[model samples]
Target: MFSEHRQRLVRQLPAGAAALLSANDIMPTNADGTMPYYPNVNVYYLTGLPEEDAMLALFPGHPDPALREILFIKRVDQLFVKWLGRRADKNTASEISGIRTVFYTDEYWAVMKRVLPLCSTIYLHTNEHARSENETQTREDRLLLACKQLYPLHRYERLYPILARQRNAKTPDEIALLRKACEITEKGFRRVLQTIRPGQTGMQVAAEMIHEYMQHNATWAYEPIVAFGADACILHLRANESVGKDGELVLIDAAARHQYYNADLTRSFPLNGRFTPRQRAYYNAVLRVHKQVAQSVKAGILIKDLWKISNNLLLEELVGLGLCTTADISKHGAQHYLNKHCYHNVSHFLGLDLHDTGYHDEPMPAGAVITNEPGIYNEEECIGVRIENDLLVTENGYEDLMKTIPKEAEEIEDLMNR
Candidate 1:
């Protein structure tokens, strides 16, 4: 699978192009404190190795087959073994990545000096995701600057755009991992439903989810968002601090990560295992839009059009619920009238990252994994209803990967009460 990812990039490269991707830096926190290390996804996507300070360079048309593909890792010395506890040796790195030519970091400059003079263009990796703020410089970002200073003349291309096109579509291996992640997430949600009670704190419900994922040998794709009452009105409320009363709603937005692939899901439940009349009414309305929008997704549909379908359906439901009228929407723009309740977009590309890399304006392609999440929040009434499911786009339509995870109100009530 990793070989196929590398070959896909090679197929897009111009002749005499050398592409380089480096590992992420170990970020530091307070004095002598460092955050957990995560391998650079671009490097991991192609090489299947996650060690820090690793480097991968691909020169497709190089005369030397050995230099055609090379990987660099920190040398397994006594110091490294003593502190970091046995980083991958050259042999192990090659064994895992299937790259025959592996070198120590000390050899990188010598290797690159020899390879770059033979290539006409250099492809470099950087965070090109549209939503990325890029406030801090990255290891790859520094490499880009240094290459321009030293080589000075070779044409450089952005490798991220090429990679985005490749990574946006899931391969068979990637799909399998995502499917497993969704299944694990399903287990976590089920754990919550079985144990959560009306008197429990929101964090207590969150603890059930964490414990379940840990048992499955998985980690959070992101922190769980478990909010009760009007706290749900704050979209990013993650503390799960307050107590959930018998009549209030608790929204749990959480998922599990399996083998580097992630699934995203969100569900709201009543603490008493049965929604009040008003809560059920609003919940059913969101469910109506969620179901319809999910069915409308398929290959070749413009992403914007999907948003339009979700927005129109949600607004019409609100009007039907007598929250507002057609006249109100027309007088004050549709968004202005509905923004308080339905503020966020209904879908996003899901994969290695919760919001994975993809062109926002592009058509939904076959084999792409995406999310369908439609939500409504009423701050005054302290009600928030969001139903999310993961989907796989096919030639004809989409397959709900989370189909086994119950979403209908009756299904949830059944599980909780039983």
Candidate 2:
């Protein structure tokens, strides 16, 4: 799976370019402790190694075939192995990554010196996601500074854009991994359906979901959002403290990360296993919009139009729900109603990161996976409903990856009652 990914990247590099991708730094905590190291998605995509201090160098135009691609990983001594268990050896790395040449990270600079003089252009990796922060300097950042200082005259190129575009389109292998994650997510939701009830704390509900994910050798893709009633109005709920109450809804936005790939899913259900008349009204409205927008997914469709389609459908529902009138819409515009009760952001690409790297404004191509989450939140009325599902765009239209998960109001109620 990874060898093909590397060749996809190499094909786009300029004839005389050398590309470098570095692993993430092990961050420091408050008191002599270090945070766990997360693999750099760019490097992980290419090499599949998650060890700290790892790096990947590619020189497609290099004269020697053996020097064309190299992967460098940390070398551990016996003492380190005794304490921390086993690490990937050179042979293991090569087998996992399909790259024939592997070296210890300590030998990185010496090897670079041999190949740098022969390449005319250098490609460096950095976190260029729109949501990324600039607060801390990463290992990749340090690498960029040193490479520029050591080889001052080399023309530099950005590798993020190339990788971002490539990652937007998933391969069959990546799709299979994401599907596995979705399957795990379904297990979590199914467990929630059987156990959730009034008087349970939000954290307890999240526990049920996490239990299923961990049992399947998966972890939460992100922090679980288990908000009950009006607490669901918090878009990104930070604390799952609220207690479930009869006739109220519990909104759960959680998924699983299996083998580094992620699935994002959200569902809202009644605390007592059945929605009240008003709750069902609001929930069905969001479900209708989710279905309508999902039909719009295909090649050459602009992502912005998805928001438009969802908004337009939500607007009509708002009028029927008596939240607003056509006259009010004429006066306040759709934003007024949407801003008050719903989130206009309907979809986002999902993969390694929860919000994956495809450009939102452009026409999406086949193989793109996006989340369809249409939500309605009314804090004052103590009702919040959002239904989210992962989608895979295809040449014909789209495939609902989470279709088997119980989503309809009748289906949810039946599973809970049974």
Candidate 3:
């Protein structure tokens, strides 16, 4: 399955373009303080090597498989293992990744020196692609600068676009993992429905979900967003402290990660375990947008095009709710405030990363897994509703990975109220 990923990546690169991908920097906190290590997804996707401080270089034009791909990782040490838990030895890394040629970090410079001399155009990866918000300089950025100084005459090209285009689609094995993630997420949501009550705070609900994820041997795909009442209006709200009122709604945007595959899912329910009349109207509208947008995803489709269609669906729904008039829908009512309300687009690539790393402008291919999430927020009404599901594009239309989860109002209400 991953061989297909390699083949796709090879086809996109220039005939002689040798690509280099590096893991991200393990961020530092205060003195002697460090954040939990998270492996970079792109490097993991290509090599299936999960350790930090690793790099993969691919010289597809090379004549032999031994010289075609090279992987570098930190040398395993007994003291380091005791300090940082177990580390993958050379043999273990090679076995898991299917990369035949692997070397310790100490030998990386020597191997690169050899590869650089043979390859003309070198594709170096940097965090230069367009994204929502970014501030930290990546390890790849530092290497890119060093490589330029060392080999001034070597033709260096950006590899971000090539990889992003290739990663936009899903592979069969990748899709299977995503499905498992969605299944875990569904279990958590159902658990929440059973445990939620009017007086409980959103934090309590979040804890229940966490327990469920851990029960299924999964971690959070991203930070769980458990917002109640007006707090739900904050699109990226994390702390789930606010008390859930009896009549208001609770918006839970959460998912589970199995292995490294991620699932992005959002489910909104009433604090009283049944939707209010007004809440139902807005929630159903968001559901409609989600449904319509999902049906449009297919091979060779563009996310930007579907985004436009989704915006129109939101507009139409807003008009129906009398949040704005038909003239406002025609002009710039729902579309204008979509960012403030929905905050994010309906879709993004979902894989090893929750907001998986990849270029957005490229066309989505047949194997790619993406999220179709559409939402609406009304601060004044203290209502926020978002419905999200992971999708896999195929020769036909698309496969909804989260389809097994109850989404319709009646089904959700039955589950919650029962």
Candidate 4:
């Protein structure tokens, strides 16, 4: 699978170009302990090897066939394995990455010295996400600086855009992994539904989800959002400290990751297992918009168009609920009026990262996976209703990847009470 990804990237590179990708650095925590190491997504995409200090160099048009693709991994010794377990050996690395040539970290500079001179352009990967605000220097960042200083004549090119474009469309294997992630996430949601009660802390609900994910050999895609009542209005709420009160809605924006592929799902249900009339009204309105957006997903649809569709639907719902008027729409526009109730967009690309790659401006192509999330937050009423599901764009329309997961109001009530 990773070999296919690398080949796709190789096809995009210029004839004389070579690309370099580095795994993530082992970030330091308090004193000597280190934060959990996560391999750089780009590196993992190319090599499928997950370890610190791992690197990949791709020279598609190299003179020596053996040197075209090389993978560098951390060297393992008896002492090292005793503490941190065994790292991928040469054969194991080769099998996983489909790159025959594998070298230890120590040999990387020597190998690069030989490969760099033959390439005119060096493609370096960096954090190119629009929301990326990385302060700590990654191993890739350091490599980029060193390469520029060492070889002044080599033209440097951004590798992120090329990879992002390729990664936007899911391959069959990638789709399978994403489905597995969603299935794991469904287990977490079901468990939480069964465990949740009025007195349970938001942290407890998050713990139930995390426990389910870990049991399935998966992990959290992002920080789980377990917001009860008003906290759901805070889009990025991560401090799961509040208690769920009776009659309040508990919004869970959580997902599970399988083999680095992710599934993002959000479900809001009554803490006491039955939505009040007002809560059901808000929830159903959001669900209606969410369903419409999911149905509208198809090839050649621009992401902005989805936002327009969602905004229009939300505005209508708001007007019907007497939250806004036609006068408000005319003065502030439908989007502005809808923003008073729902502040965020209804969709985002979903895959490896929660907010995965793909340009929002570009037309969504077949195989692109996205989230259809329409939400309404009424601060005065202390109600926040969000319903999210993963959709895979198809030639005809879209397939709801999370269709099996229960999202209906009655279904949630029954599951919770059961």
Candidate 5:
């Protein structure tokens, strides 16, 4: 998948265009210390380069073949390596990434200037995708502006949309890694099921998941969300506390990452190891929608249409539960303030990013992996329920990646009790 992605990005360029991608900067937490380093997804996708401040440039279809793909990495000094820990040397970077051409950071401009004149249009990368709304700044953002000023006449284009389109469908190897990630998530989910009880704290479950993840050479794709009762009503809740009372439903939305591929799963169980009547009703409704969505997830199904189907099912279930009626849905739109307790959309694209980048308007094709999670939350009832499974779209049908994870109330209760 990584090698194919590198070639695909290179293919985007014409005979004489240069494409450049930058690594993520070491973000500061406070004071002199810095937060943990997060690799840029694009760089990781192309070259599997995880270190900070690395740069990759691909001058595809060049006249001289020596300048196809050039990688610039941080120079490793003994003192810096001792303090900041080991950084990749040029030879090490080349060996690991399978990119033969590499140089020190000091030579980036010199190399770019040598090849810049050979290419007419410079494909400058920026976080211009819709998901970049939350980004305040980026290393590529600064470099793009500076490059444009330095060479005012060069034609510059945004690479986010281009890369996003290419990354929508997974390659065979990508699907394998994604499946491995889901397997790790299954292990963690099973661990929680055996360990959870009425008095257990949310953080304890989080700790257990991390322990399992470390044991299996995996890590949480994102922060594991362990919310109980009213806490689950607040989607994206992160307060891992033991304040949840017995008999409340504990909602756990967690996943693990394997080699940069991601898996996402959400399961809600009871604190007392058995679902109450209210919880069971809502949980079953959501599960029905989840199954229906997975069943319908074949080639040529638009994501928006899938959401509409899931929402309609939820509306029917709401009416069944006496929470809302057909007239209520008719009078108010889906954004009906009354139904705000209804959690966010059913599911999203799952891969490198938790909310992976992909085209939603077009029908999802085979070779794509997505989540089918249906959830309902009621603050007044102090109950929230969600059931999720990772799905891989296939030519014949869809396969549930997290199939082994228990979602049936009986199975969940049995595991929790045991």
Candidate 6:
């Protein structure tokens, strides 16, 4: 799978160009202790190896076939292995990455000297996401800076745009991994439903979800949002300290990561295993919009259009609930009323990362996966409801990856009460 991904990337590159991707640095938290290392997703996408201080270089037009693909890894020693365990040996690295050419990190400069002369352009990878606010210099940053200093005349190109375009549409193997991730997430949600009680703290509920994920050899794709009642109104809420009241709704936007692929899911259910009248009204409204928006996921549809459709459906529901009027929508615009209850967009691309990379303005392609989450938060009523499911775009329509995960109000109540 990794070899096929690398081949696709190589085919996109120009004939005389070379590209470089590096593994993430082991960040330090305090003295002697380091934070858990996560390899750069792009590097992991091209090469299945998930270790720090590793790099991949691709030069499709290189004269020697052996020199076209190179995998550089950390050199192992007795002292380092004693502390950090054994790193991948050459044969192991070759087997994992499907690249026969493996070299030590210390020999990267020597290998680059031989490879750089044959290429006129060097593709440098960087975090180009609009939301990225990375201040610390990464391994890729250092390598790119050093490359410019060494070879000032070589043209440098940004590799992020090409990678973003390619990674938007997942392959069959990636879809299978994603399906496994969603299955693990379903287990976690079921556990939460079975364990949740009226007096349990949000943190306790989050622990239950994490326990289920860990038991399945998965980890949190992102920080779990286990918000109770009014806390759910605050998007990206991480402080899971509130206690669940009997009639209040608890919104959990948690996901599990399997083999580096991610599954994002959100479910809002009542603490007492039944929603209050107002809570059910808002929850059903959000579910209505969610189901409709999901049906619109297919090839050649812009994500922005889906947002527009969701907003329209949600506006009609808001009018029915007496929260907003059609006159207000006509005068102040639908966004004005929609913003009162719904703060975020309806969907986002999902894959290796929770908010995966993709062209939002462009039409979605087959094999692309996105989240359909339409939420309504009423601060005055202390009612927050959100329903999220992963949708895979197909030639005919979309596949609801989380369809089996209970989303309907009666379904959730039945499972929780049982």
Model 1 residue 242 CA deviation (Å) reads 2.2
Better of 2 and 5 by lDDT: 2
Over 1-418, each residue of candidate 3 has an lDDT whose tens digit, in order, gives 5556666777777876788888888899999998988987788888787788889888888877697878888886889888988878888888777778889887887888778777788888766546646776778888888888888888988887777666666667877888899899999999988998988877788899889999989999888898888888888899466787788888888889998888888888788877878888998899889988988988777877788888878877876887777776557756565665666678877787676655566667788888888888889888888888888888678989889988999898898878
Which scores greater on TM-score, model 1 or model 3? 1
Model 2, residue 388: displacement in angstroms?
0.6
lDDT of 3 at 339: 60
Candidates by lDDT, descending order: 2, 6, 4, 1, 5, 3
Q: Once model 4 is optimally superposed onto the true structure by TM-score, how far is the C-alpha of residue 334 displaced, in angstroms?
A: 3.5
User: What is the C-alpha local distance difference test score of candidate 6?
Assistant: 0.91
Of the two candidates 2 and 5, the one with more favorable TM-score, higher being better, is: 2
Q: In model 3, where is the ten-residue run with the lowest total lDDT?
A: 126-135
TM-score of each: 0.98, 0.98, 0.93, 0.97, 0.96, 0.98
C-alpha root-mean-square deviation, each candidate:
1.2, 1.2, 2.1, 1.3, 1.6, 1.2
Supply candidate 3's per-residue lDDT for 301. Answer: 79
State the lDDT at 188 in candidate 3.
93
Off by over 4 Å in 3: 1-4, 63-65, 328-334, 337-343, 357-362
Off by over 4 Å in 2: none
Native-vs-model 1 lDDT? Answer: 0.89
lDDT of the candidates, in the order given: 0.89, 0.91, 0.81, 0.90, 0.82, 0.91
Worst 10 residues of 5 by lDDT: 334-343
> Tens-digit lDDT track for model 6 on 1-418?
9999999999999989999998899999988899999889998899888898889999999999999999999998999999889989999999999999999988998999999989999999999886789999988899999999999999999999999989999999999999999999999999999999989887898899899999999998988998888888988988467888888899999999999999999999899998888888888889889988888889989988998888888888888888888888899988787778877889989998788998878998898999999988888988888899999999889999999999989999999999
lDDT of 2: 0.91
Q: List pairs with backbone clashes in candidate 2.
A: none
Sequence-dependent TM-score of model 1: 0.98
**Model 5 per-residue lDDT at 316:** 76
